[model samples]
Target: MVTLTSSTAAQRPDFAAIANWIKPNSKILDLGCGDGALLKYLQQKHRIFGFGVEIDDANVLGCLRNGINVIQSDLESGLSGFADNSFDYVILSQTLQAMKHTERIIREMLRVGREGIVSFPNFGHWKNRLQVIQGHMPVSDALPYHWYDTPNIHLCTLGDFENLCKQCDAKILERRVMKQDRPIRFLPNLRGKLAFYRFERQNKSPKSTQD
Candidate 1:
């Protein structure tokens, strides 16, 4: 029943796009919620009830100022406090590269929510490819950092993500690769700046059948 202030609704398009992807009136959990923009957008637009988990003190305070419900926690520690299927969706946006155990956190996302959406900068972007050929790290809008100063703990390509999805028993329901802000449909592994996927965890076999 929360509504966005008209001023906040006019801010940016990407947040609008993210808000559109969420199901209306469903529970959501946003991990690494930077500034709580996406959660506030969802609450205002779709009437979704959810809380954001942010570690940065400034961001946590920002969420409070924005009238968003949020929990202050480090993602590296995992989401053990939340029960399985506690939320309809769990979102991780532009924060995957900074995690130490990416796979484990992804699994936790699946366990806590019925479905999960993950978005990250693609290390195989065309510019990055060129940088590798030139023996230097690529610096672009999506990944704007020098190697020594970057907080990214893991670098992954599109192919790597596909393999990881397979290994984790997650089924991709929707995917988008973007160049700048435009969606890229062809050879995304080579041309895209970021990759987004909506996924669900595959059901496991019964214990009797497994044995």
Candidate 2:
């Protein structure tokens, strides 16, 4: 798990970065929003209107305790509760790999909001690759789980995710790769253990009205 920073917000760096991308007073939806920390922080810092969707009972209670508007639902069912462009941003943080229907959920995110933000562990990091070379799955700070008990099922490299966005007709707006609290500038796929992306669906041009 990413460690919380000492800043007043006390959020993980990637969460803070995600917050920065959001505009003040915008409507936001957070998926798998454990404990509602990010949404609460944004409510206080950005004064944004935020809602959370969590499947776990404890987390749903946590969102209530945080005074965040939330609903208990499985993401696998998709975001059918919300209408198209219902929010300014929809976020799925560090939970993409665990999803059973990755493409469908991503499409749902874009469908329900103007933009989507996703973050996940980079399975192609050097440490993971080294472990693979040694015929073992990696056990690291970013992915601290054994193969059998791990929730993550469809882990992928940075390139894999980008290609997926393309296939979904999502336009990439920004991408960031990180190692702990710091951003990685060089050889991100090999060095960075985490990847973050902000994207939106492609728009079709309007037909000409002229005869």
Q: Which candidate leads the pack in TM-score? A: 2
Off by over 4 Å in 1: 1-13, 204-211
If scored against the real structure, what TM-score would every candidate get? 0.90, 0.92
TM-score of 1: 0.90
Which window of ten consecutive residues has the lowest lDDT sum in model 1?
A: 202-211
User: What's the lDDT for all of these models?
Assistant: 0.82, 0.87
Q: 1-211 in candidate 1: lDDT tens per residue?
A: 3356755645544565466578899999999997788888887788899799999999998888878889999998888878778899999988999999898888888788888898888999888989989999888888899899999878899889879988788888888887755789889999888888888888632111111
lDDT of 2 by residue, 98-199 (tens): 999998888888888899999999999999999999999899999999998999999999999999999888899999999987889899999999999999
Clashing pairs in model 1, backbone N/Cα/C closer than 3 A: none
Question: What does candidate 2 score in Cα RMSD to the true structure?
Answer: 5.3
The candidate scoring highest on lDDT is 2
